[model samples]
Target: MIFYIAKRLGTGIVLALLVTLITFLLLASSFEDVARTILGPSATPETVTGIMQAKGWDRPVLVQYFDWLVHLLQGDLGVSVYTSLPVADSVVQRLGVTLSIIVPALILTAVIATALGVWAASRGGVADRIAQGVSLVGYLVPGLLLAIGLVVICAVQLKWLPATGFTPFSEDPAAWVRSITIPVIVLMIGGIANMAAQVRGRMIDELRRDYVRTLRTRGIPPRQIVLQHALRNAASPALTVMSLEFIQMFGAALIIENVFALPGYGSFAFNASLQGDIPVILGIAAFGVLLVVVVNLLTDLANGWLNPKARVR
Candidate 1:
């Protein structure tokens, strides 16, 4: 297991480095323009040149990259061009807000989806029909539409929750929950829909395998055969789908945050992009790549544990 984990970690590290390099190169293409944007239009050419030189933009590309990478390793993501705040600090603060909702939503998604899927596979009838209906609704209904409708019913009309704004958990835990409830629900629905379908399909296939029949013939408990053997085998694919869903949730969170007026990493990144704040943009890009690498690495580890055959390959 240690060896397996190490190999996955190594691969993730390499992928992260490659992604950061590519992202840096893309951002570097307009490096000078970033300085110009910072200095404003009225600044003279010499002033811009002076600013660039001070920032070491005059250095070789490789040198600048290495310097940036070193700073990143030191937890310094540079200062935002517009806000002049440390990118790392801003990202961490906003990321906390995003994760507050995303983590809970993901947990709910995993539990609910796994249960619905396993139930549908084990007892095909109304359970199967219900799971299928959920899958169809998840596929057809857009998250944004659901969020809007939820706000209208739950927040606007019903007044059960706040329509906009967020409260920090540290400040008021109950208020924080109320603020993120709609957003979490929106994210959870989409995730459950996608992962439940994947899990149900995988579970159904696993239960039909010859091993399952053999186990049944051997007088093994039905629950043990289904839960321990079949579900374990089926989990790898569902886990993979869940990891991908985690990434997709971040994308969807952008729109959901806007609707709820929650200040999160998505809203922060969006505003940074609009202002072309290169430092913040680059910082966000690096964070995104790192996130993907970490999620994939975790998924690989979980898959390997569930299916030892994966460790060999």
Candidate 2:
């Protein structure tokens, strides 16, 4: 187990470094850069050169990337040209905001998807049809449109919650949770739907195995057999799906963040892309690639935990 974790952690670090190198290359190649954006038409040649030299933009792209990668290793993400703040500091502040919505949403997604999926898998007739139909509704809807619909129902019609923005959890934990609940729900809706489908498919397939038939012939109670045996075996795929979905959710949350006016890394990345804030944009992209690599490696590790057969040292 220690060896497996060490191997995965090593792979994740190497992948993250590669992602940073690739992002720097892409950012440098782009026509619009922070120096160009900040300098605008009000620049003399010296001023332009000064801005480039100051940001190390005047250096060869490879040299700039090497310097930037060294700083990243030392936990320096540079300064945001727009905010006049350390980019790492901005990301740190915003991470809490993003997790305030994501963490609870993930819990809710797990519970809802597991229950609905198990129930769907157990039911074979009209009941299964009903559960499947609801999953379809969420799966087919676009995240932005669904967020808009949720706002209409909860904010406009029910007047149950505020439409947007964040409340700091430290100052008012209860209200902070309250402020984020609906957005979290909206954020998770599609994820839960997709998870339900994956879980249901895996559970049903597990139930069809020869061991399940043998248990049935031995007159094992249906509930015990399904809950203890079936769910354990079936959940392996669901765990994999859940981990990957989280990686996707963070990237996909950009549209949902803009729709709901949430100040998250997703929203920050979206705006950075539009303004061509190369450093911030590349930082966010590097973070996203790191997220994907970590999640995928963790998912591979999870397989050993979920299935007794794959417990490599």
Q: Best candidate per lDDT, number? A: 1
* Model 2 agreement with the true structure over 1-313: per-residue lDDT tens digits: 8787788788888888887887777778663345666888786778777888777787788988888888887988787778777887777777667767877887788788988888988886775787798789888887777778878988889988878877888888877876787778777888888899898888899899999999999999999999999999988788878886787677666776777788888888888788887768767766677667877777778787888666563
In model 1, the worst 10-residue window by lDDT is: 23-32
lDDT of each: 0.88, 0.80
Count backbone overlaps in model 1: 0
Q: Please give the RMSD to the true structure for each candidate, in Å.
A: 1.5, 2.1
Which residue pairs in model 2 clash with each other? none
Deviation in Å, model 2, residue 310 alpha carbon: 4.0
- Looking at model 2, residue 155 earns an lDDT score of 81
Residue-wise C-alpha lDDT for candidate 1, range 47-75, written one tens digit per residue: 88898898788788778888889999998
